[model samples]
Each structure stands twice: as structure tokens, then as C-alpha cells.
Target: MLKIQEIRELIKLIDKSSINEFKYENDGSKIVLKKNAGTAVSYQTEEVPVQPVVNQAPPAIESAPAAEPVKASPEVQQESKAAEEDSSLHKVVSPMVGTFYAASSPDDGPFVKPGDQVSKDSIVCIIEAMKLFNEIESEVNGEIVKVLVENGQLVEYGQPLFLVKAE
Candidate 1:
């Protein structure tokens, strides 16, 4: 049987590698991992038999195809360049899989927007998971540089939802 830690390592390995899918089998257990077209990853593991799993080194990150260039308006281009050059920018990632909400309700304004100031513990957004609405906070003092996800969009765990330029 594969331990939980082993499974986590495999997940991290697969996420970093260029390969899109991975499979492994031992005893009566079978494991298959597949990455989605978006940022999410999913995997399946079957029942285990008697054999112990052996550990192996992680796979190296391979070079993938170059992406096509994106064209944008002049103002957007400047903002993108500035964001790329800023080293103090911090990404606020989702802690769990959920639908992203820019505000508490549809009629309410967003908790924060681009150029808005935020401090540690500020509730910048909400994540609805399993019927629970979780207020996501910014852990660093910063200015909201960008919002990566749209309201009412499904977000995966560890996906970056905002870019903040730390003060």
C-alpha cells in the first residue's frame, strides 16, 4: 500500500514534470494520475495488496512547447510588463477547491480591487466549498496588483487567485 506521504510526493512530482499523465501498479493496487487542461490535477488509486511500495527520486522538469504570444492593449501590456518586473509580488492561493466569489453577495462590492490596499488578515475574497463560505485573507500587507480568477468561477486548491505587491 502506498502511504499518504508517498502519494503527496508523487503529486508534487507529476505537477512539476512536463508529462501530462503517470501510472503505476504494485501488488493489487493501481494508481493513475492525470493533469487537467486547466490548473487542476486529479488522480485515482485502487486497493492495495501485501507488497510495500519502494521510493524513487522525483522526475526532472522537462522543457515543454513554447507558448504563443498574447496580444493586448497598450495599457494592459504595460501593466503586464510591470508585474513581470516586480519581485516583491506575492500570490494569494486558494486553500481548498471551491467557487470563487469577489464579494459576500452579488449586490455587494468586491472586498478588494486592483490598486486597493490590503493588510495581513484582510478578507480579500471568499471561497465556497462544500456549502461553506470561507473568507480568504491576505497574509501580507500589500496592494492588489491583479485578480486572477473571475467571480463565480471554480478554483482548485493551491491555485493563485490574486497577485499582491507587498508594501
Candidate 2:
């Protein structure tokens, strides 16, 4: 446990420093404090996970096409040929780091699904980031060919979220 004096000294150090967030844990007590420039500070405490750590390297993946049977459906084959000829049906990527919400709320239906048509500025879904819910708009006028992420999955910036076939 930290003494009151120690906590006060930590606050003082934070005020004098330029760091935005600080977290510390000791003797079963944990504290998280954040200071935003020109914004009020926030404080919270939560228990930390105690688990054994393992450092294992991930396997590398090949980028080229697989050397197996090149079987494709008639529609998929035509689409692939057309895709090679065109450049519009590429990808729509996420613009921020957040949980990908396919619907506005859990009980609500998905905003867009495979085979759904969309227009420019159409709200496809919501992405919750930093405690803020942001509506994601479709930048391309197209039909959704595929949804790349499951609902509520963590997504990174620039990650491909959908395959949009230009209309």
C-alpha cells in the first residue's frame, strides 16, 4: 500500500512531467491516473491480471497465391476477372482503433451485411473508441461483398473491414 505522502509526491511528479497516462501497482493496490493537456485529469483503479508470461515468435505467412486446385465458382471467377480489369472494388478500411460494432446496439440488427447496397456517406456501422461511439460512413457507393471482421472485434487503424464492389 502507498502512503498518502507517496501518492501526493506521484501527483506532483505527474504535474511536472509531460506524460499523459501513468499506471502503477504494488502490494495488491493498483492506481491509474491520466492528465490531458487542457482537460481534466481522470483517475481509476482496477485489479491487474496475474499470469505467467511466455515470449513465442509467430510463424511467417506467404503472400503469393497457393499452389493448389484453382477452383472458383462461375460468379467468383467472373468477379475475379473483372477485379483484375478494374480497380474500384478494392477495400474499405477502418480509420481508427476500436471495437467494430456491426450494429448500433447488441439487440439491433446489423447496419450492413453481405449483398447489402450502400452509397457514399451511408452509415455502415459504429466504431467505439476512447469511450466515444463514432458512426462509420461508406466512402464508396457500392455493394458489400464481404465483411472482414466479426461484431465487437478489436480492429486497428487501416485494417480492411469490408470488401466493397463498386456500383
Candidate 3:
């Protein structure tokens, strides 16, 4: 059986590589990994007997024909420009998958809000996992531009929680 850390590393490796699909079988275990444009990574595992199969060359993957680019309308162009501007801001991302908390307790005020200035060590929020509350700190010195998450939201690892304009 593969360990959790090993599976994580495999996913990272597949994400960075050109291979879109990978399959492996050993003993009574089988694993497959696949990726799509919008989907980061998807995998499946099953406990089945390994079957003996002849080694065959992989099928050639043909590239799709490219189509001419369509020009965007004026309104669409304006919205695209605005999105580009927002991309310049730094993001405070979740370090682990957990339930996000905006304050220490239900009655307490939030640790930080939009327009607040924070240093690298400032504790911006808390994340609860397995009944443990972890204080999450900002890794950058910046002024908070926006809060991306609401209180008590389920946050995924690496998901952006706040946007900031760095000093």
C-alpha cells in the first residue's frame, strides 16, 4: 500500500510532467492518475488481482487543430483588464485543509479585516483540523486588500484566504 506522503509526491510529479495519465498495478492493488485542463488531479485505486498483459507501445496522441482567435468585445476587454490588475496583489493562502475561523471565538472580533496592515508574523486567522485550532500567520508584510473567505468556511490547502498589497 502507498503511504499518504508518497501519493502526494506522485501527484506533484504528475502535475509538473507532460504525462496526462499513469497506471500501475501490483499484487492486488491498482492505481491510476489522470488530469484535465480545469481539474488539478484525479486518481483512483482498487484492490484487484494483477493481470499479465503484453507490453505494447503507447498510442500516439494527436494534437487538436488550432482555431483562429476571436476578438473580444469592448466590455469583455475591460473586464479582462480589471482581472489583470487584481492579479498583482499578493495572496495569503491556506497551508492546510481545515475549517477557517475569522476570530478566536464566536463572540470575539476578527483578527484582521480589509485595509488592515499586517507584518509577516501577524496571526490573521485560525484553522481547525481534527479538533485542533491552528493560528495561521501572514507570511508577507502588506495591507489587506480583501478577505476571500468567510468565517467557518471549509478551506482547501493552498486556497487563497486574503489578498494584500505588499509593502
Off by over 4 Å in 2: 1-88
Best by lDDT: 1
Any idea what lDDT model 1 has?
A: 0.79
TM-score of each: 0.51, 0.50, 0.50
Residue 70, candidate 2: how far off, in angstroms? 29
In Å, residue 120's CA in model 1 sits off its true spot by 0.4
Give each prediction's root-mean-square deviation over alpha carbons. Answer: 14.1, 12.4, 13.7
- In the predicted model 3, the residue pairs found to clash are none
Question: TM-score of model 2 relative to the true fold?
Answer: 0.50
Query: Model 1, range 1-167, lDDT digits (tens) per residue?
Result: 78889988988988898876677777656776666553233334454343432343345689877444334568765765667556778989899988889999999999999999999999999999889999999999989998877788788899777889898
What local lDDT score does residue 110 receive in model 2, on the 0 to 100 scale? 98
Q: List per-prediction Cα lDDT, in the order shown.
A: 0.79, 0.74, 0.77
Q: Look at candidate 3 and tell me the lDDT of residue 48.
A: 45
Candidate rank order under TM-score: 1, 3, 2
lDDT of 3: 0.77
State the lDDT of candidate 2 residue by residue for 1-167, as single tens digits.
77778877888888789886677876666666566543232233445453322332334676986334234468865664554444667577889988889998899999999899999999998888889999999998989987777787777899767778987
